[model samples]
Target: MLKRLALSAALLAAVAGFARAEDVTDKLKTSAAEVLARPAADYVESRVEIKRGDATIVGTLTLPKGAEKPPVVLLLHGFTGSRDELPIEGTKEGVFSRTAHILAARGLASLRIDFTGSGESSGKWEDMTPQGEIVDALAAFDWLKTQTNIDPAKIHVLGWSLGGLVAAHVAAERPVVTATLWAPASNALYNFSHFLGSEAVEKAIASADPDAVIEIKLPWGATTKLKARFFQSLVTVDPVAAISHYSGPLLVIVGTKDTVVTPQPFAGESFLAYHDGPEGLMVLPTDHAFDAFTGPQTVDLMAAASLAFIEGK
Candidate 1:
């Protein structure tokens, strides 16, 4: 009986090891498919840094395939988000990924990165500000210019949510090839205040520690130990003013049914006002995240429209 038990244990261990190996192999195969099937656009994974006095802000850059000098795009994500948001399984296979890959198909290279302390990045979120994030995007652009495969004059910035604010600011400061903001904030103060008033936000605050406090009076009564500089920096940011100075093609997309940044009251004319360049506006019957990308839309209008604008069609 003892010998039989020992044999059974060994067999189970061998089977478990085989199963684990198979799982790993499957993941690798899936990843390879995603890359190998990446159309004509080539891609590379790299890193960059932005000097902030003695500190260096770091980020990742994913370049598309092309032999000649390619147009480079800097992709920015919203607060409490990272580049991972773009590559998420469903999200990636849906609109944003398709949009990016299609850009690659058109010879545009995109650099999607995490902010300091976000994702694989270093630095504390409390130590970063919206302005800091913009500076980082600028740094990524500078790095792109140094690459032999990229055209300095063909650089663009694509910001999503709060990232839009960052992209707008960068476009204003640099000679970007184009610009796009996905469900961007019309006004920092308004958006922040709006979020505070939401039921979800109230729950977050209620569940937070009582000792925490925010520097700025949030729209919601809740507060946190979030640094004072972060709040102060946001108070002065004006996305409309920032984008008003950009002359390249501009694309603004927002969901009509978005409750997070409510389109009708938050977007509408305000979006039309700042997008003075060649512009495109897409209002989908979706939410902030554009969950509709998962549906059987055949082709995502937002992605199609964005790709068309970015490719200058």
Candidate 2:
């Protein structure tokens, strides 16, 4: 019935000269253009696992489509966080996932991993230490460099919180193209002392038992358990000092309201003093995690800055 109605309407229109054949062809052309204007997914992602001596690290790898050996970024999550990170209240995706999509949109690939003891990775959370995370990140970087989809000379590492510290150290250890840190804790021991309490960390270091666990309750009510080495490692591993060895491009992003990494942008900006390469320090008014509590727009802004820096803009 609908087809017959369209036929009868076309016949009437022809007789009345209300519409012309060229006009129908123009309408079809406009509809085709509208269809072509819509955007489609231009990247592919998969769950990948990397084997380490202690435990297996699980992560997501997102790669841009139709790029020859596209540059890739290694995304390291914040302390006690998963690869994708927590979902913003109003959004369906996590911060790292969103970052990966943003990078892919600009023809870059990304790999975001859950450090050992977090997310689906093996090992207990109590054993996590900054030194170990650096090792894990190095392994991931090495793996990325060897992957057929990546350009070995173009791999970058981006991290947040403690992971930012790890990324900085990784840059020092490897020939990374660029390093991006989000609200980084340049001074890990000083930063952790504020939350873990100096007394707790000191007690752990002073303890004679290597198997001893120092349990500290976070303000959010979650308890973090780690060995004395965790604190000791934090004290010994300084990203600001280590970053001096990394002469590649560096981008450090900080939040003014961040209490975890105190003194505003200095926790981030300190890297500039030691580096002799292209670098930038972006300071925003939002809190740690880029105010994920408020909205994801803040993260998007940071992502934009990150892409520009990585692109050498």
Candidate 3:
């Protein structure tokens, strides 16, 4: 975003020193790609669509080379974000794009979709709800399982922010291999109530008008209209409980300055307390979006950790 190419290169080179030992033994050693900034190669990408009722969920499916049936990772973006997301403001890469390429380098396939209404998908923003997102995520999972080339049993999910909440429910519902959440909003009501004031949402829902929509400004200074149902989902979805039902390993990544899902390590720590399984939590020193405003160190740390975890390393 703020031209961190120099910083990314420096940190990645230093990190490479730590991987020298593994490079000699590991089957697919880490690539030469500089910290989450890499072009799409060694993989094949295609446009894919999933049907949810009358709406079409558009996505980009990435299939990595080397593996005859590569394992897949479902990449879920944060709230109000698209499939590839905002590209870190200035760079040509966003979170999911880097994740897809990095995983591809390690012989892992990925599918990043525009969850209904937010990206290239067809739906109204006012009608978007957590429950609906769960439905869409499950539909994507179902579709992925039917694909001819990908390994059906090794599919994992990686979600960020509010999408983490949806990913939780999706993992709980599906027989996923592993579940990874980056800066997840497990306590939906608590997190939204702090950012999206509960008073205004309650008032809009109480209105007799069925078409009632209220305009609220996001923390990033953008105003958006929301229907009453979207607010109700804040109280309805329980991702913490959902995580408990998922039998696979869980990885929760967060930063110390994550104001959206505040209190840092504790918010992440709570996620493991509810679940009984192999779990990991990576806490960085940057903000919610993994050092979007700061340098790329935190993001690099997270990307490395996520890759290792998903690779079962």
Model 1 TM-score on a 0 to 1 scale: 0.72
Residue 124 lDDT in model 2?
81
lDDT of 1 by residue, 76-176 (tens): 87876777353333443534445556567646677777777666666776676787788777777777777776777788888878888888889898888
lDDT of candidate 3 over 1-313, digit per residue (tens):
1223343344345434431111111221232223234444487789998997898999999888666888899988888888986465445677788778777876789999988988889998788888888888999999999998999988899899998988999888999899988888867766776566656655655767646687888878889987877776677889988998987888887778888876566666667767777776665667878765444444555665676777666
The candidate that achieves the highest lDDT relative to the unseen native structure: 2
Model 2: worst 10 consecutive residues (lDDT sum): 18-27
Off by over 4 Å in 2: 1-41
In model 3, which residue pairs have backbone atoms overlapping below 3 Å?
none
lDDT of 2 by residue, 1-313 (tens): 3543453355344335322111122332343334333453499999999988857999899988887889999999988898999687688889899889878867789999988888988888888888888888998998887799878889999999899989989999998889988888877766776656666666777878767777787867888788766776776788888888999888787778987777665556567767777776676788886888878877777776677677765
Model 3's alpha-carbon lDDT is: 0.75
- Cα misplacement distance, residue 257 of candidate 1 (Å): 1.2
lDDT of each: 0.62, 0.78, 0.75
Model 1 accuracy (lDDT, Cα): 0.62
What residue pairs are clashing in model 2? none
